[model samples]
Target: MTAFVLVSGMFTGTHVWRETAARLTAAGAEAHTVALTGLDGPCTAPAGGIDLETHIADVLTVIDSVGTAQDREVVLVGHDYGIHPALGAADRRAERVGRVVHLDSGMPQDGVPALAAVPDRSLRARLAAAGGRADTGDVLKPPAGADEWRLWGSTAGVPDATLDRLTALAAPQPLATLLQPLSLTGAVATVPTTGVLCTRNGASIETVQMMVGFGDPALQALTDPRVTFFELPTGHWPMLSAPAELTDVLLRAAAGEGHRLVPADAAVPPAHLRPFPLDVPEALRERHGNVDLHLPDADGPRPAVLFVHGGPVPADARPTPRDWPTLTGYARLAAAGGAVGAVVDHRLHDLSDYERAAADVAAAVEAVRADPAVDADRVALWFFSGAGLITTDWLAAPPRWLRCLAATYPVLAPLPAWGLSGSRFHPARAVADAGDLPLVLTRVGLEAPEIAATVEEFLAAAEDAGADVEVVDVPHGHHAFEGVDPTDETREAVQRAMRAVLDRVGRHGAP
Candidate 1:
C-alpha cells in the first residue's frame, strides 16, 4: 500500500530520493520517489527543450498508485524547481493525497517557469564562464559534479549528459504555461501542506522568497494561517548534506504536523517512450534545386514522396509514437513506390537565415527531380506541422515543385505568446501573410477547440491563397496523431493524405 510520497528537488531525482525513501520505509511508511522524464536521463543542450507540466504529471502518477493500492493517501513533497511538479501532481491527485510538503521549492504564483525563479545572476554567470561542447552550439549544460555545481552556484550538480537525455526524453514545454497566472484556489494549497525551507545557501534566498509568494496571497500578503514554514541551516540538499536531520523533519511531516495544500487535477504522464537513435548521414546533406529523394533501401535507387523537414528541433524527432511497427522518419519512405513514403528534415528556425532555409528546400526539390529512380514528374511534396512555412515560401516565392500538399495539423496562426503574436514578416508571419497556393491542406481535427480553430484558420488561409484545403477531424484533438499509429482510423487518414498527393502527382507528374 502507498504510504508516503518523497519528491526530489529540482535538478535531482529518485537517485537523490533514495536516502529519504529508505528512511521513510525504515520508519514503516511505504515511500516512492518519482523519477521524471528528462531528469532521469541526460538533457538536451541549452537549445531549449523540456516539459514542466509532464514532470508534474509524473508526480501524480506516483500518488495515483495509492488509489488502487492504499486506503490512506500519501504525503507529497516538492524541492526547489521540484515545487512546480510536486504542487502540480497534488493538484491532479488530490483524492489520493493526504498532504503536500514544499521543501524549499519555488512556487509559480505568477505563471512563471521555475527556471525564472532559479537565481538568474547565478545562471548567467555560469553560462558566461563555462564553455560547452561542440554538438549543441552555444547551449550551456550543467556542471558535472557537486563541487562543480557549487562553483556554478544556483543549482545542485546535474550531469552534462542530463541535457542530452532531456532533449530526447523531454518535449518542448509551451512557455505559456509558465507565463500563465497560477490559480490554486481549489487544489494542493487548500489541502494539508507545509513548506520546509533550507536557508543554507544565499543562492536560494531569492527562490525562497518566490516560494513564499506562491502560497495563498492572504498569508503571502495581508494576514494568514494554514501554512507551517520551517527553516533549516542546511545547504541545498538536506537529504545528502544532512540526511539524519532531514529525516527527523520529514518524520514530523509523516505525523501530519505541516503541509500547505495542493490543487486537484494535475496529472503528468511519467515516462515517454524512448527516442530512436539518430545517425546524421553524410549524403543526407541539403543541396540545390529542392532535392527531396528517399533511398528505398538506403542502397536502393530513387523513392516516392520527399519530405521537407522543419527547423528548431532536430529534423528527426516526433511525438512519442503509439504505433511501434512503423518507424518514424521512414514512414513516408515506407509509403513510397506503391507504399507512399517521405522523410522531412526541417530548417532550423533559430539558426538559418531566410534565403538559406528556402534555398535548402529548393535544393532538395531539384535533387529529388533529378534523381533517376523517382519519376521526378510524379514526385510529391509532404510538409509536416510548422514545416509549411518553408514549403509555402518555396511554393510562393520560387518556381513551383511537383503537385499536392499534405500537412498534419500544421501550425496556421501566429503564436498566442505576447511578444510572439505579431504581424512581423518572419516565418509564421510569412505563412499568415501568403498569397494563393495549391493542393490540399489538413489541419488537425481534434476535440480541442483551440487546435480546431487554428487548423481551420490555416485551411481557410491556404484556400484563400489558392490552395485546396481539407480539414480532417481527428476524433480527439490530441497530439496522439504523431505517435499513435496503431489505430485503424489514424492509418486511414494517413492513407488519404498520401492518396490525395499521389493523385496530384499523377496529374502534376514531373515537369
Candidate 2:
C-alpha cells in the first residue's frame, strides 16, 4: 500500500486534515498526520526550546515510524508553514521519501527562513508580538473566533463547522519555524515535487513566476524535471474546503499523473505531457510575440504541430489572456498521438498586422524546430479562426520543410464588416497558389452564414487549383464548438480532426 503523510500549517495541527485523511484511507492507502513539536499542545515544549531543526526531526520521526516496502511508495504532503519542515526532512532523508506535495505553500531556500519572504509589515508585527523573537515566547497564533478568521482571509470557502474547529484547535506556532533559516544540499531536489495552488486568489504558475523573478530558486524548484503543477479553484486550505477534490489530486499525484489544470468538462485527452516555455527575449515579450509549448512525454526528435490561436485582437494594450487549458489540452491530444504541440501568440492588433503575425509564427516555428526534442523536418502548422488569415503567406508558397497544414472554421477571406479588407488579408487568393502540400479544413455546420460561404468558396478555389485538400464537416457545430460547450459530439470531433491532421502531415503521424 502507498503511504501518505500530511503535514499541516502554522497554528494548525493534523486535526485540519481529518476529512482528507479519511478519504485517502477509504481509498485503500495508509494515511499519517503529523503534529510537530512545541505546537502539539499548550507549553509542551518551552517557547524558546523548539526551532526549525526540532520540527524537521519531528517529521523525520514520523517517516521512520511508518516503515517501508519495495513496492510501496511514501508521499509527503506539506501545507503552508508545514512545507519547510517536510521539505527539509525530505532533503535529509531523501531515500525514504518518494514524492513531496506543496499545497498553497512557500518553498524553502538553503539560507532563507519562512519569515523573510513575508512582505506585510502589519502581519510581521502581529507575528513578532505573538512571540517570534528570542526575547519573545517564540509562538504565533491567530486571534480567537470566526470574525478573525474571516478578517484574516483564512475562512474563505471554509465551512462554519471547520472554521470553528480550526479556531478552537489552533495552537501557537513555534517562532523558530519562521525565524530559523532552512538549509539544503540539493538532495531533496531529486525527489518528485508537485505544487497545488488554490486559485480563489486567481494565482497561476505564470502569474507567480512573474511576481517572483523567473530565476528565483524557489520558482526554479517548482519547475524542476520531476515537478508537476496543479490548480484548485477553492481557497488555500483545500483539505478543509475542498477535501474531495484535494484527495483526488493527491491520489493522482501519488500515481505519478502529469499536470491537469483544466476543468472537468475541458475534455483534455490524457497524454504524458510537460509544460515547455519558449525562451523568448524579454525585449520581444511586449509587442512582438509570446508562446507556450506542450511537448510529448516521449524523448528526443518527436514530430510537432505549431498552433496559432484565433483573434479579433485585444485593444487593451495588455497581453491577451490565453486559455491555457485548451491550449495544453490540444497539445496533449497531439502528444497522445505521438507529436509535440505548441501554441504561439503573435502580434494581432488588427487584420493589417498579418505580416508581423506571420513573422512571429515563423520565429515560433523556428524555435520549435530548433528544440532538441523536436524532429526539425517533421513540422506542421495548425491555425484556428481569425488566425487562419495568417496562413495566406504559407498557403501562397509552401516551404520545402513545411510538411502540411490544418485550419478550423477559418476566416479565409477578410470581412469588411469586421475591419478586414480582402486586399489586406485573403487566404482564398493564396489557394490557387497552394502547391501539392496536403491541407485539412474543418467546417462547422452551425457557423455564421458568412463564414460558411467563405469556407465553400475557399474549398472550391483550392480544388479547382488541384490543391490536395481534405474537408471534414461537423454538421451541427459552431465556431470553436468544443470550447463553446464541450460535449460528446464536440469531443469526438476534435479528436477526429487532430488524428486526421497528424496522419496527413506525415510527420510522426499520431495514432
Candidate 3:
C-alpha cells in the first residue's frame, strides 16, 4: 500500500482536510494534505507570483518530497475543483501517481485549459431552488440560517428567516474553468480513477449533468477501465454536515473501496442537549480569517445571546463552549422553562473591530428576530465575568432588538470603580440607561457577604434609573457563579430567577 496523497479542491485550503487525513493515518497509512500554489496567495511574492502550472508543480513537489521516502504508489484524492492539479501531477510524475480519486469533483478533459473543467454555475439555478430572485456573482455565501448577512459575517446560530434571506443571497461560482477542457491523456488511462458525487436538495441541477458529461463518449480518452463511480446521499457539501459518514466513504475511496456501494455508519451521538441562547455571531473560536462564530442552533428567532471570551482565547478550544449550555444542562432547563437559546462571537483581538463587534451583536439580534423558532420580542443578553461588564455597557445603549438583560456576577459601575473615563473604551454607558429594562443578576455566596448587598445597591441604583431588577443567590460558590450547573438546587435558583424576571418583563411560559 502506498502513502495516501490527498488534495483539496479549488477555493478551499487544508482546513477541512484534517478529518480525512486523521482517519487514514489511524488506519496505518501515511496521509498527506497538499496545499496548492497561488490559491494560498503569496504574501511575500509581490501579490501574485504563482500560476496554474505553479500549482501543478506544487502537487508534484509534495509527491517528490513525501512519496519518494514513503511509498511508490499513492491513493490520490482530489476534492471539489482539485482534480485539475491532481491529474496534472499524476501526468507529470507518471510513476508516483497510482490511483486518482475525484471526490465530488469535475472530470478532466484533454487539450482544454484548466478552467474549463468547472461545473455550470447559474444564479438562476440556485435562486430557483432557494425560491429567490437575486443575482450574485463569485462570492458564494454560506446558506443563511435566517438574514441579510455576508458569508464572512454569518454565524451558525442565526435564526431561520434571516437564514433564508442570507441563503438566497448565495453567489455563483466562476465559470472560467467550466468553459475549458482538462487534459488527462498521458497518465489517466494508466491510473485507477473514481468519482464520488455529492448531492442535496439545495444543490444545483448541473452537478449530475457534469458527471454525465465526463461519462459521455466524446470524453473517451478520459475514461478508465478501473473507473469507479459513487453518489453520496447528501448535498454538495457532505463533508461539513456529515463528516463522520463522509469520512468513512473517503477512507473506503482511499483504500480503493470507495467505488463499492456499501453504506457508511452514522456519526456517534453527542453527549448532551442543554439549551443555551446562541444567536450572537462574534468570533467564538478563530484561526486567522477562519473564525467560527456562533448562531442559535434553534429553529426560529431567538433573542440572540452573545457571549464574549475573557480577553482572547486560543482557537483550539472547540465544541464552541456555547454548546455546553445548548447541548448539555441548558436543554433540561429550557424544557422545564420553555425558552429558546443562542450564543455568538465577534472579531477576535488584534483583528478586533469594536464597531463591528457592536454591529455583529445587533445584526445577530436582527437575525434572531427574523427566525421562526425564536421569539424576537423576548430577546435578551447574558454576560459572564468581564463579559458581564462588557455586556452591561452593550445593553446600556442596547441594539434595537434587545428586550431584556441578565448577567451573572456582573461588574457593576466600572467607570467609577476602575477609574476609567466614560469616553474611554472600557464600558459603554448602555448599562446606566438600560432604561425601564428588566434585569436578572446571579451572584455566588462566599465571595463577600457584602457582594449581595452590593447587588442590592445596584438594584437600588437601577430602580433610581427606572430599570426593573431581580437578584438571586447561588450558595457555596464565589464569583462567576462557579459550579452553577442545572442540578436540582441550581435549577430551582435559575427557575426562580427566570420567573421573577419574566414576571417583571411580563413574559410567561412559551413566548
Which candidate leads the pack in TM-score? 2
Identify the runs in model 1 with alpha carbons over 4 angstroms from their true place.
42-49, 68-71, 122-140, 146-148, 151-185, 203-225, 258-511
Tens-digit lDDT track of model 1 for 176-250: 223323434456556666667665443222223322322323334211235555655555566665666677777
Q: RMSD to native for every prediction?
A: 19.2, 17.7, 18.8
Residue-wise C-alpha lDDT for candidate 3, range 325-417, written one tens digit per residue: 432233233323334444554432211233345455556556545555556666666555434445645555655446567766554433111
Model 3 CA deviation exceeding 4 Å by range: 41-46, 69-72, 119-185, 201-215, 219-225, 258-511
lDDT score, candidate 3, position 141: 27
TM-score of each: 0.39, 0.50, 0.38
Per-residue accuracy of model 2 over 1-511 as CA lDDT, tens digit each: 7899899877777788899999999999989999787666542434567888888998999998898777778899998778989999999889989999988776677887876434233465465565433543556655488765543333458888877777777777667677888989889988988888776522345334332221233343444457777778676678989999999989988887756333212244211111222211111011124666565656567788887876644434223423344555676677767677777767765444666788888899898888777788788899887787888888998887777889987878754223244244678879888899889888898876556666788888998999998787788776666545456666666777787878865544342
Worst 10 residues of 3 by lDDT: 261-270
Ranking of predictions according to TM-score: 2, 1, 3
Instruction: Specify the poorest-scoring 10-residue window by lDDT in model 1.
Output: 263-272
Q: CA lDDT, every prediction?
A: 0.49, 0.70, 0.48
